[model samples]
Target: MGLKKYTNINNIQGKKGSQFSSQLRGINLERVLIVAIDAAKFYQKALLCNYYGDVLERPFFFGVNQDGLNLLCSKIEEARMEIQAERIFIGVESTAHYYEDIVYELGKRGYGVTIINPATTYEERASALNWSKTDDLDLYAIAHALIQNKGMENKLPEGAYRKLMKLTRARRSEVQKRALVRIQIRTLMDHIWRDYQGFVEIENNKPKKKLIFSDFWGKSSLFFMEHFPHPSSLIDLGEERVWEISKENKLRIKETHIQTLLYVARKSIIKSTEVVSAELLLLRLAIKDLKRLDENVGLLEKEIEKELLQTDGRLLLTVPGIGVVTAAEFYSELGDISHFDNAGQLIKKAGTNPIIIQSGGTQGFYGRISKQGNKHLRFMVYTVGKSLAQHNKDLRPYYERLKERGKHARKAFIALGNKFIKIAFSMLKNRKPYESKQPDYRIFTEVKKKLLYTKMNTYLNIALAA
Candidate 1:
């Protein structure tokens, strides 16, 4: 309703001029804070500040730098003390790891904080019909989004979902760093060795830890490297030692394999023969580090699994294709499921929501996924759907159903993935575990959700007495 509808003024005491407050339920956001991050020294501010009849104060400016995090932490501390802040909302455009500490500082201090995606800000800016862009514009957009979107349904998220967000972001960072090191190892092995790929199959799945750590990379294949142990001494050692190591390693070699492994450890044209020794040392260390990261990633998966078991994941695993890991990812990121209103919302967020391509008058043909949701979750669903199509009897019929209707293989999988959405909705909404057709298994209950959320300690005695 527009603010204009509530015209007349009155107080319970029948005051002369006081207006009756007709504002709807929940806290009202009268004042807001926006923190924008940028690498440049100057940025244009473009905040058109009214939202839902609330006006934002002119934004105060601040700069972020290498050590700006310390200042941000102190600034938020000051804001908490400066105002009563009945409904203080803090918004920032999450850039790099800048938002990491900023969001952490503000959220850690107990303010209502939202680190908005750039898209959300752009959508809101479009609604305002403003085309200009600048740092100032962004700060205002952040404030506008906060006041307008706050107090809407589904605003509060479960605590666990936030934890999962942190974990995924941290994991991505580690994966990126590991790729850099692996590339260096690849370059070394390519230049310093000739038979490296043939022997180790590093080009295959990866420099697998099971293979690398077992004396396979150094001991089993060392003689096969382009610059073998000794170029001048291959004559003294003869072919016997090379043949013995090859057979013992079971490398599936013919007689030519030994010749290649023992080939002049130094070809006159070997480009970097001078650096071969040093390069080998670096490559070995890289393999060792890669092994450690592989183990760490596995440990993280197990931890996520343990926590998901406590939450509602049965709804996810009940589907034919989803396994423990996929189900854990679904529940962990999607939170309590009640946050979504229906199957459509779930599908849209899962990026399984189908999009229609229509022109001004003509109806267009089929289109692909909107692809506008949690990509990790969507990927998990797709993989599960693929597995189900291969091994699941129930899924086979659905796959055929789509194919008969002229859907492509990929389209068929998407159709099943869409159906998976409904199963998730039913499971999460009903607070039930997922079991297949038999329907006899009970997965788990949200223990806190039951018993009116009263503490199970001595507090229970007080409740009974009352």
Candidate 2:
């Protein structure tokens, strides 16, 4: 069948045209063909359009495999030839991992690609046309958004940064799995030994005593659970046997722990029996899984550390309290800080920037953060910010001042997060290690004045050179 044509560019030239014109200044629209694909798991729905949001062809469907990618590329070539376009710009919605293969394929075929956030396409649909949803409609929205330049340039990580991301993400997944197993173990313990937590308590000078097994996932606790699944089993083994088991497992605990366990076992309301054998089995399985996950996490961390050392990530370690893990996370997420124009952009990308709410002539008040960017990066920034607020010399005073001014704990943390972004950005951009001492006010003033006079590109070049 012949390709369908849409020549009424003026109809879409009102708001979308102006937005595109402002954001996309240099690109000549007349010679460029825009291809937007609504990516899915099994298939992709695509629309080919011209520079001014004119559809040059009807929506096309293609598979996601090798044959499908080739068909899609051939269709794109056909569209380019029909439109007599000099360049092709392919736009695809970033729908999880569904778009990765297509994007990589398009890149390998030498097409300029933009990865549009699904949120952007949704907003575009809502604003441009109040229509029902379909694959074709979604494809239209993606194409429309691309013509308006409402997407990010698709640039995948490479080298050490790529490996770091893979390792860190795997580690995070394993940690989450481990946490789930711990919860399951705790739930099983509640049924089999409800007051097991009270067995060993250390008397501190503080009012609240500390339980040794409060960390339910500790090595000793897991060993105890695996060997003696219930209180009756523990009592049957006797205190000396328990101590012997602890010694065999190389657990550094006092003999008093055994006495505590025996006492709690005698007073325990729950008793072990053949009926509870199922619970014991579950407990043993959970412990085994937890141990495997722990080993996996440790191995992934070691690999992450090794990969991080190969990059300039070690420079981040110069900042007090920013250890290898936090630094590696930042490196993996940011993927070369030189790409960012300024620290504010980095902060916004991390989603720590405060959201301002206002309407009409009303004054705007700062609400919570947008939380619209990389949540993992935001979490890492928050944790690093908390550490800095407590320990970093310059940041601690700032944190205390905010607290003294009655700022909420979370708000203070957000503020510290913002500060951390700025400091880290400057340090990384300038290739300078962090200094604990605060700079002189005079030097700060001079630096601010110099920044004002310096062109942005020139400043970036200088920073990159450093």
Candidate 3:
């Protein structure tokens, strides 16, 4: 229930062969410096040597750029130059927004760079937080996490991944800018004209300032303001003039709207103003930015699909529920499947493993993921699992089976996703495509019969006792 109860899977008691093997084989990790950066804010911490659930050296203050990543590469380069020892592993958490700078530089330098989840480092720091948070202690926690998870198989992202990461980040930026500008546009509209509030129609329900044109073709909005232009100027001009304009616009207008346009134009008049030009400019720029981002996303998706069809890529993609994108992401991140000796390492990376809460005589579990591994990989798997559950008939039986055994729907879904992750890992390691495993329907039927029989027996026994 508290910090003391949090446990790490440091040891695997099971043996694979004649002798026992460590779940993780430790490197001389004390020579390592693990770096973690929070991308949303300008925060980064670096710990010296072997801290990923291991203890060797302490953590320290690391620097992030004013933009959270501008200076990241320089810091990595400096660390590599200074720590001219056995090895240097820089582990960074994937804080949603892409850390292309960090991943590219560290991976380029041949350092054991890992893109992990920030929650993992947070859990690691739980023990060390006596008072408050500091960059120094954070670096230590990250370093400790690296040590604890030594022999941690990091999934090295590929070229397509880089492209995906870059495109996704750009898309996020454009989306943010649009959000701000949209607010300003909405505020302006509400102030000038509140009659048409919520009447604006959007094709896909997406918000856009350009849709405001539906309220005023040109003169209508201008006519509303006393100092602006007037709709009445075009009124007495006759039906032919309005028809010519509608024809030019290709507008499908009914007779009633045509009449209203004529009447309103006759009734509405005002002076000309300059606000329309600026509004038009902002709208044009916003539309252009959104379109450009969409284009890049399309290109990135195509490349990822191409990479997915690579020989090894084909093997991964053939797995149930692991489609082109998922397979590509998995392949890119996990360069080699043989690196992981077992499924737990893979599961840990999936971030689906439950964290335990135990104290005194009571032992229980909390519904938090051990977010200490490949967060991106974990999310990918979870997403794939959901997709599979909806579409993959093969995984449906397994999911139903698990849910029937009293797992929470969301939890069971993730558990199912984790289950698929293991299967996918196997298919990758064996260089074989996924083949659906048919359910033993008879076996399930027999089990259900036995359960019913047992219930009957219990009921009879209670009757006799009564």
Candidate 4:
């Protein structure tokens, strides 16, 4: 095995191990106290010990409240007085989100608290006590992990960073919910009109599948479905009436598309004609749910934009492929870029850095990514990578080169994600906007989207009357 180096705080195996070691450098072993806590939702168990594994206080339980916090503090003070400890190091297992309160409270009172990974504690226990387990044993494992510096100091986000984190996560949840609603609506559409979305048309003894609207959720298509869900209803309304409705709503639908839709309606089949009324009611309800989710998502994005603009993360928008939502989500996960010493640190944090393997007398080669850090952050980086690969003129060449070198598409995207981290790190650290060698057309695209959105809302209001 190679000799171990106790520097680089970015090491995935033991984050901030060096910092913890530096704090213990010339101190008397017995005088240094380590407090290990196993946190739960309602109560927590804490134990105090000296550097040499001498127990200073027996394990005790306290509720997760102000009174419980005071009791824990009193116990720590008593142990410190009895042991005459000059330095105190506290560690707590990251048990769900229950540990947040204790960590935040202890930090406020000026205690140096390290957030221990549960995996480290589990390994420490397995190595020491085999399969046996208990709260007391877990506490011992926590202390051992602390002694080895197997955790990182808690750095809680504040102000805009905190808001962005919460808002971005909320937005992600809402988006996922909206997607489920879309699926439900599609299921209902299939029941109501089996061939409304597309149908076979015969001409000169050749059959061709014709799509009335490329997007089933488009304004014109949705309006047609909402007002005239049944094929018979469309046939009765006739071509002239449909054209008048489109003109009145300013839908600007193509005449050919309208004719094709009517033809499909004449030939489309309904799964059950008797239950058509029931299906229509359910479809209207589903559409209402979709509209509500759409409004919620819109409101969330606006809030996210407000929070993002208040931080240095706003500079991320200068990149061609990045938008307000992507920039905000990426920045929310990466709080305070100064915490990272280099772009490599950011890559490691996202767990996008490749793993390496080497044997004796052989050159080391990279394997897959570690996949050990913030998974959400990793996903955001990967998304940004896909965007960059497809739309970024400056970065697309590098992505193509990776693919040409026999890298898989996903691997190429991951490599681009690491590059995005480097670019983002430098941009945030130096407070510079991205400067592309080629002209950035994304700005014009964004302006066009805004104009179209305004026009869409006006047409939607007119179509709602139909």
Candidate 5:
């Protein structure tokens, strides 16, 4: 017989496409041993399998420490020798941070490691197996998933990008904390001054509503709260004394505001009692926490800005309405824009990709976004798009065009978000600044002319009828 050429089992197309077939692309399935680990905090369950997803060794238990890692490596070596395998692939679920150490150790020991999403393994278990869950079954599922290529290759940011991610996450945490503290402050104000919310001024024939204590936990507001602590105290102090206090504290307040504050203080239904003192104490403490959180957030922003300046993130700022924080967020989440082949992938990662619903022979209808990836990135992109739509030279017109085409305001913003991603992808990939060349304006001019003509014709007809 003539010599036959070797082919990967995954390359063969069967009557029904196998789920694992998609995963096996770009991977040589022949003469390869796949080890899948069901990782836990202290221990892990592992299964050794061949490229065909056939289990080679029964499930084994190993600790998460060095001893367990060594034993696991030894087992893999033995299996490789027995099967005469040229390659070994280790697949583990990216559950929390439990898999980090093992992944590091395995990579150091010269093994290819892939991180599988826990959701993927769960789906695999539900679809392929009829039996209840067990360590062995889970391990087998993970291995089979790898053979089918159901996981993404593990890639972590390093150097400046890593620093940027850390700083941005910290900033986001502090910002959220500040928001919570502001809410707590408002809740306390409700109890202390129930009628404070009704205080407003009529400006330009419209109600200009003011926040409680002038501004929420603002410097002057906090100082005033610290000194008076209650509306009754402000009432007792009177306008003159309160004005002197404001001067001493370097607070800028108009004479009318002082009079209004006294008026509200005297008319307030909530009186300060000994029991109310406790609420005041809590409110002051919450305000103090808010100040601390604000300081921390500011510091984190400075660090993030410094790190962003070192990267090509500055190019993102060339786009109108994209500031340092937004650029840093983009750079941190994306790491390198070159990893994505196109803007569509970037949009998908941001979870801004629209969903389509279809059944039977009915045409599909577009639904909301899938919201499958990084939520923070999605929010940042949406905010950036909103800002661009209002301010950016090119994007503003595009946004208006979408609205003119009968897209809802929110839907138009979503479209702008998608457009922003494409523009950002190109800008980052080319390492160039955004050029502010206006798009074709003739269409808008023609629309405007048509609308004006229609309006003038209506007015002329009305006049002739009269």
Candidate 6:
């Protein structure tokens, strides 16, 4: 069999009536006014042009504050009166957060605003054979994009969705900060107790790898780190004193682990006692910061849970592996589910959909994902995939099948992620919870309990104390 060749691929087009096309269909081009804006930190550049690419007004700068906004409104009204324009279309480049204020303000005034992607404007400029860039050039690019009906209606979400977006993004930042603190703590431990995290031990005249404690942040490990970072201190305290302190703090410490800590302390390398003492202070401070950050994260999680429950996102909890955090993050990134027509659109928005590449008389082939959509959404979907593969019995089999077919673990997870998107999309759109094909009593009972009695506050309280 011969390979299939990709031909006649140049005619790919976007769906009709998805942008401003429907409104412009029967309208006269001459009377339509196109207002293009290039936003900046403190000021913005704008120009007025008619629908037929004729500049009606030269590019002008306006401040981005209240007085400036009034000037902008007056300018648009003046231009409308001069041209006798019946329809007006305003386009602004989505430059960081600079365009947000204008979009919101204009939207509130009942002016139709189209948020243009910076990439679209750049391409428009390049097409005109003008490589040099400036605020003036950007205005022309934005105008051209709007004339061709390119841009999006970026209606900022309100109420609970807005709150979810903020909280979820904040939670991600806190998580990253916590991870950095963990790294700093490990670095300090390396200098103080060289073999604190893990070290090789000899057993039966053979090299064996051993960890003093299973988790570095476990209660007993944290107790030693807080009170006795230095080996000399651990040795000075003696096993009896260590046991007494552990009991006082209600910390469980294995006798074998304590003996191993003392052994490592005796033989471990060290610097001057003064140097150790200074590092200890920094280490304790870092630990304190870590604890505070953890509490903040727990509090944020509680808020996210409360917000998620208010929206349909809580239905995601019906899936065995999906949790409140993952659901909230996904929903926040996704915004309103009503905007998506299907699961495929959601996947495309996440940039997880595979790319199609075909050119030069070669057969069409699937390439890597575009990775051009919301990166946080992509991350959350992958997280859901990981959770489902580990805990969701129904989805685990599919994940295993992918691996059996020689897919890498990461690739398998992404495949599962796409499938999960379909599941989630259907669940959200239909306002239904997840249901397994085959009846399983245990999963049913667990899911029912989760849906009916989600005691999120209990976990938050424990986390706050920790």
Score each candidate by Cα lDDT: 0.52, 0.74, 0.52, 0.80, 0.73, 0.79
lDDT score for residue 236 of model 5? 82
Q: What lDDT, from 0 to 1, does candidate 1 have? A: 0.52
Candidate 1 residues 214-252, lDDT tens each? Answer: 233444453343224334444445678756656787755
**Model 6: per-residue Cα lDDT over 204-247, one tens digit each:** 99988788889898888887888788888878898888778888
Worst 10 residues of 3 by lDDT: 14-23
Q: Once superposed on the true structure, which residue ranges of model 3 sit more than 4 Å away at CA? A: 1-10, 13-117, 131-135, 146-281, 315-323, 358-366, 397-409, 436-466
Candidate 5 clashing pairs, residues 3+ apart or interchain: 20-148, 23-149
Q: Give lDDT: candidate 3, residue 290.
A: 43
The C-alpha TM-scores of every prediction are: 0.57, 0.81, 0.53, 0.82, 0.77, 0.84
Give candidate 4 regions above 4 Å deviation. 1-15, 39-47, 51-61, 93-96, 117-143, 202-207, 240-255, 276-279, 439-466
- Angstrom error of the Cα, residue 29, model 4: value is 3.2
lDDT of 3 by residue, 1-466 (tens): 6655212343242222112123233444344445544333444444444323343333333444334333554565566556543455566656655454556655655655655557766776786687446645655555555545532334444555555544444544555665675565455444433322333335788854322235542343322222222244344556787666656656655545556545544433332325345543554454455456555655656655544443355455444455555556655544455656777667765667788888888978666777656665676667777777776677888788878888777776787778876777787677655575545333223222322113434433432453
Better of 3 and 4 by lDDT: 4
* lDDT per residue as tens, model 2, 206-256: 455435465666777777778776888878888888888889989877787
Structure candidate 1, residue pairs in collision: 44-136, 45-136, 45-137, 46-136, 46-137, 314-434
Clashing pairs in 2: none
Q: Which candidate is the best by TM-score?
A: 6
Instruction: State the lDDT of candidate 4 residue by residue for 1-466, as single tens digits.
Output: 9977566544444445556666777888899999999999776899999998888888999988889999999999998998888889899987877988888898888896887766568778887686435648989998988888766436666778778888888889888998998887778778888788687878999999878899888889878777777788888889999899899998889988889888888777645457777888888887888888888988888787666655677678678888778888898877788777788867876778898988998999999987645667889888999999998899999999999999998999999988989999998998877778885455334323433123434433432443
- For model 4 the local lDDT of residue 161 reads 79
TM-score of 4: 0.82
Candidate 5 off by > 4 Å:
1-30, 39-45, 57-64, 129-141, 197-214, 351-379, 390-393, 397-415, 438-466
